[model samples]
Target: MRLKNKTLATWLTFFGGPLGLHRFYLRGFGDLMGWLLPIPTALGLYGIERVQTYGQDDLWSWLLIPMLGFAIAACALMAIIYGLMTPEKWNARFNPGADPEALPGRTNWFTVVGIAVALMVGTAVLMASLAFSFQRYFEYQIEEARKISQ
Candidate 1:
């Protein structure tokens, strides 16, 4: 029933995306995804705790840490997508009852900033996730090969 501002949506997605705050903003609390988005974020956080407690060498860290990275990256990407949407498209999708040129859907300085932030953060997170997963996997493989060769 209320208007959904593009700037607010973009910022929320960037900041609280893992918790599905943006989804709730646009789609409301009943949105299943809004509730479920935190699962991987929580799991990834637990993975960080595991690494802290058990160290990076722990297999669980290798598996679980990537979940956090991927979740963050995905959220960042979503933020970018939301920020980049055209005013017509944004209004149509999020504020169906409003005018096509509604101010809430209009692009603004804040929206651009949010998009930039999302782009920077998302790319870094994605790269880090890929690097981490590959590095750990190769390290484990090398260890296994060394053990067999011995």
Candidate 2:
């Protein structure tokens, strides 16, 4: 097999992880996780559409929107992991036939940038999802409480 580039994998995970492009690139189409990643991503997109059509008060949309955020956050974290992986580990895992010090596994400026981007994006996404889901849930609870008091 051809040598897999760590920098390329890092960027792919950051940009296309939600769609499983990174996983497929590394493990090929038979990777079950690669095939499954898109399901949540699609559901999340559908949720966004539902919110646009039915508004934020839509229960399904509230539940589903977080899925997309979580998926994105997960992918970003994966990118960070890929970026930080040691050259030896990266080669061992993804380019088993290549030398441990293979050039493709070496860290580069692109990988550093990819790591920074992934960290920033992942943290933002995770925070947003948590904030959104909790806000909606608390509002729902307050509404229920008011109904009981009334």
Best by lDDT: 2
lDDT per residue (tens digit) for residues 1-150 in model 2: 788899999999999999999999999999999999999999999999998999888888879999999999999999999999999999999999889999999999989999999999899999999999898888888989999999
- TM-score for candidate 1, please give it: 0.97
Q: What is the TM-score of each candidate against the true structure?
A: 0.97, 0.97
Clashing pairs in 2: none
Runs in model 2 with CA error above 4 Å? none
Superposed by TM-score, candidate 2 places the C-alpha of residue 19 at a distance from the truth, in angstroms, of 0.3
Model 2 lDDT vs. the true structure?
0.94
The CA root-mean-square deviation of candidate 1, after full C-alpha superposition on the true structure, stands at 0.8
- After superposition on all C-alphas, the RMSD of every candidate to the true structure, in Å, is 0.8, 0.8
lDDT of 1 by residue, 1-150 (tens): 899999999999999999989989999889999999999999989989998998889888889889989988999999889989999999999999899999999999989999998999999999999999899999999999999999
Lowest-sum lDDT 10-residue window in model 1: 55-64
lDDT of candidate model 1 versus the reference: 0.92
